[model samples]
Target chain A: MASEMNDKNDKRGRLENSISKAGNMSGQNQNNPSPGRRKVLKALAGLPVVGLLGLQVLRKTNYDNKHSLQRQLVDELGLSDLMSSVKPVTASEGETLRIGIAGFGVRGGQLAASLGFMEKSEFDKKSAAGSLDAHISQGNLNVAITGICDVFDLHAERGIAVAQHDIFTGGEIAKKHPVKRYMTFHDMLADKNIDAVIISTPDHHHAWMTTDAAKAGKHIYTEKAIIRREEEIEPLYKAVKSSNKVFQAGHQYPQNSVFQQAKEILDRGMLGDVSHLETTTNRNSEEGAWIRHLDSNGKPKPGDKKSIDWKQWLGNSSYVPFSTQRYYSWARYFDYDTGLYGQLFSHEYDAMNQLLGIGIPDTVVATGGQYYYTDFGDIPDVLHTNFEFPDKGYTLTYSANLTSSKFRPRSIYGKDAWMAVGGDLTVTPDGRSEKYGDMIKRGLVNPSAPMIEIKRGALTASAVDAVSSASTRYYEDRGLVSTNIGGRIWDVNHLHLKEWIDCIRNGGTPSANIEKAYEVGVTIAMADISYREKCRTKWDPVQRKIIRL
Target chain B: MVSINNQKWQTGILVALRFLIGWHLLYEGLFKLLHPDWSSLGFLAESKWILSGFAEWIISNSSVLNIVDALNTWGLIAIGLGLILSLFTRIAAFAGTGLLLLYYLMNPPFIGMGHAIPLEGNYLIVNKTLIEAVAMLLFAIFPAAHCYGLDSLINKRKKN
Candidate 1:
């Protein structure tokens, strides 16, 4: 009976142990499944939100990436249209022309002196010693009168004297006839003997003076960018066309010899398929803005407006209170300037446009702000803008910053090579073996083989091994070489002036005529609109219109 | 377990944002420190129009100006650290935004637009200060600090 009781007790204990184990297993399964279900549900619920966030992030990233990539493409490539069939324009030898300049400002004065020096130097070298004297005697070439037009009475009582006796350098050209002084451009234009007129007035007056000069049958050589508004460009173009007078816009770099050489090399396909281009002008000081300092008395002096017609200065712009800052530094105000875009950027844009063979870009986007000193000025201290030409498969990135002096050397990146123009023309060739070799040698990267580096100068050429490493191992292997090209060959101002003079003397096409000037003006004006709208803008070349994008 | 998991995720997000903004500020300050030539103090001193007459006079004094410059450098570092660690977040954000606003007022982007075409010139519509201010404002408005940061840890301790 006792043995039977022990057996039953042992069996009961075993049964209790199995029951406890089963209970623990069920609890574990329930706890683990609950958490797993929770996780799955949470992940499923976040699908749309996460996907949406990712899409938005991608869009922003692509937008930012487009600029750098496009810049790289445009800078590296050369435009086929820019290499259009070249027609050499040759001028026949003719009588020395008598030229008289009436206005004197930064543009007017600079051009007058440069042209005078160029003409005198060329004449001295090319002509017989007595050729100038003979030309003057024959009434073909004479200094005539080179005096200032004081429409504003800025130069005291005496107009800026053009007579050799009146200037500090009078002795050099003392024997030449004194430049006849005129109080007004109208007075100068009225003289039938005066064959040409150079208008360097404010934007508002550019059209009026040029139109009048054309109507008077005098050739017109004018400073650019032509005007502010598209509407104005049309009228100016029409006026120049209707008058049947010779006209030239002063975008002189096109005539520069160095630029020509660069253009020639680019045309030769020295740089492979160009992909990007970038240009910048960084200025961190107020002087860069062209703000003139005030006089000690805090009053603007009369000489401030020397040779400047005050009324003509007002032109189509609204009348405002006269301040020396505005008078001397007309570029600081919107009424007289498109700020840096018109004054400085126009020059660069013309070069790029001419070189790219692209008209106003299909799209333009700009972002910038003033983060520097504040004064009476009303322009941003820093600005960055991008222009996209989809059809041309290129883009241009431009930046201006006043806060930092970091300067990026302007460059064009091509598929096979890169081209940089400033101090020298650097050509970087592309390939993979060159990059891989550098990486392997560096040990930082294990790549298959060595690379070659070629260095080219104006007269020297040398080849060196390329070390390939992970960091140095560029995805594209290319060799780079540089050569110095001489400066611009043609004087843009002189050529334009000569064209204008030639067109007047012999009716022919001017190099940068009214139509081209108008085109450039419209393009720049649209750029301003894009900036104002904070969106992309497009220009219709056929219709000559700007459409905001 | 659910509460702990949520806390961890939140902490991760807060950490990420703190480092993003904190590092930006810290980098700016450190850059100024490393490159003394990059200092704008001399520029500020030379400014004849922006600063008030009294401020200009004060800045003209070398001893006082030096102290102010040192304070500015350290203040930027402190603000960066505070934000990154989720310590004194409110104060750091406030100060950062304030500095940005001052920069914006100093040079505006509209001035650039007012200039030439291609709209390049001294304008004030877009600038670094404005961008930073917007970032700071976003940070200040969101509960980023509390999401996955020291603030959350502190709160958890308090709850326990």
Candidate 2:
């Protein structure tokens, strides 16, 4: 009986030990897991939590990577107030046209100088030229110049130089006059006297300044590349729309007579069904990149700084240790400028979009990099992009490089004929063979069809005739066509700027208005995104959403 | 697992490919930067293409292009250096891929059809650049850097 009791005790001890071992194993698994059935079960059970944690980690990392710099900059600058609550201002009945400039850079300075000239010229033109100062008088115009809102010091210097040069040289002035230049753009806007402002800063600042100007009830004429980032565009449009002020985007090419003629020709189907459009810019120089050549004496002295506000110069970008590279060569950096796309490509894209009557590209793809110079620049030196519009049945290829001097033919190829303006328009007719001309024309009733083999480049008279005939046919068919095509093409910039001034005087939509500018900005922004992602990007015009490829 | 001869052949092919691609890019970049008279900007500006308006502006301002050229040269040098196991293998591979993509998109192989064979006119889908980029990607993916690089030195030290 004692032996049986001992056996039971031993069995009990064994069972307790097994339980302890399992418990110890589980504890170890809390620290580390061995390959076992229990461990496997634990791992399987924890998978959902692990996946959840992983997803959170991934989301945090991505957000940090993309927005960390922007967040830091925004926080540092205390730009929260600047972004929100844009108050609309109504044009006063007898308010003088108050104008403020966001950037006091080269472009800004020129604009300021031009304004000064305009102020002096207003009286003279009214007295002598009979040129209607109607836009200036009647409380329509007033001038208030603002210093560097966002740009490097060197860029500001260039602006100063340009202003000085304009004052000395003739630029939109009947007589040179001195204009009051302010230290800060905010001060200029806050004065409550300024009527309009011209934003001549880099691409990023254009939207912000324009929005602010509109909020301040100031008319605006912003340079090309209305805005760089996609998100900023809508708010700008809204600000402009809400404030019933004249808004003009600088797209000088459309104003050009040549482009106008080309548009007319395209409308008439003179070049046949346009299938492909290719454009390229391969500038290869330091000057071409718009890097201001800075003086050896680093940052300007305090006295000089007074003349050119340094603090205002380092506007929205990171407050880096002052370097001439940042100031003179701002375009080289992606932070300040959109490089070629915003500065140069914007004009071309806008013109093409206008000519083709396309709103925004359905797909955009870009590829390039800063491969050549070891300079302090972040923007790419070479860029090749394509905007595909499936709805329009066409694609626009844009290429720009700093390296090669290779200039390829930039023309639109159509189904019937290829039209290369500045050169002859070549029209290769369909179904016109040497031997088989009549063979395929079985039962054709029209025998008097003109049999012209390669009609030499259209003469002025012939062009006029062609335009009239095409217009007649178009009218009969209920199509949009031009009857006039022989006049010389005008300078698009001259015409565009004139239109803006005219719109200010006589209420009407500027040639390159808000909607068109937005289209151009969205397309270019999509291209930049596509380049970064190495895939196609699409822009929904109606929704104004950029779909990453 | 692979034979010594096969390894040698693979290494040889890779080296040849690297040299060709690296040299081509390096040469093109150098040629542009060195020749002042021959400017990409001027050519582009003068071209009868769709974006000539902007091309003219870019051509007029070559500072941006100069920066681009400098980057291209360095990128090529880096690719060459990486391929030869000098330094930064992954960086070099990434740059090469980037450069190839840019070139391919700027002027696609299949620009205009109906002139000749569909893909014959200016259409170079599988060009030297695409091939090089692919090779670089492969090298980056595998442990090719260890075969003849500082990676091997680090591995040896660790083993010791």
Could you list the CA RMSD of all candidates, in the order they appear? 24.7, 29.8
lDDT tens string, model 2, B1-160?
A: 7654343444445444544554555545544444453435433433343444444444333355456556665666556545444245566777778777665444444444112213333434566556666777755644432233443344445868
How much lDDT does candidate 1 score?
Answer: 0.54
The alpha-carbon lDDT assigned to residue A482 of candidate 2 equals: 14
**Interface RMSD for each candidate model?**
22.8, 24.8
How would you encode candidate 2's per-residue C-alpha lDDT over A1-549 as one tens digit per residue?
Answer: 999999999976764444323322434535454544443443233234334534655686678867664454335324344312212212222222434556655556434533432223433443353222211222222222323343344544544433332221112322222344455566667765556677877665688888888888877889978887787888998999999888999775554333454566567574456778876665655555655545436443222443435455566777776555666677777777778788767766776777777788888889898787657587788899988889889999988876654544346666654544322222233353322234226422112331111121112221122123422232111111111122221112333444665567668998688888888888878987787667889776667699885
Candidate 1 — number of clashing residue pairs?
74
| Candidate with best TM-score | 1
Candidate 1 CAPRI classification by DockQ: incorrect
- DockQ-derived CAPRI band for the predicted complex in model 2: incorrect
- What is candidate 2's TM-score for chain B alone? 0.63
In candidate 1, how many Å is residue B89 off? 83
TM-score of 1: 0.51
What TM-score does prediction 2 earn?
0.49
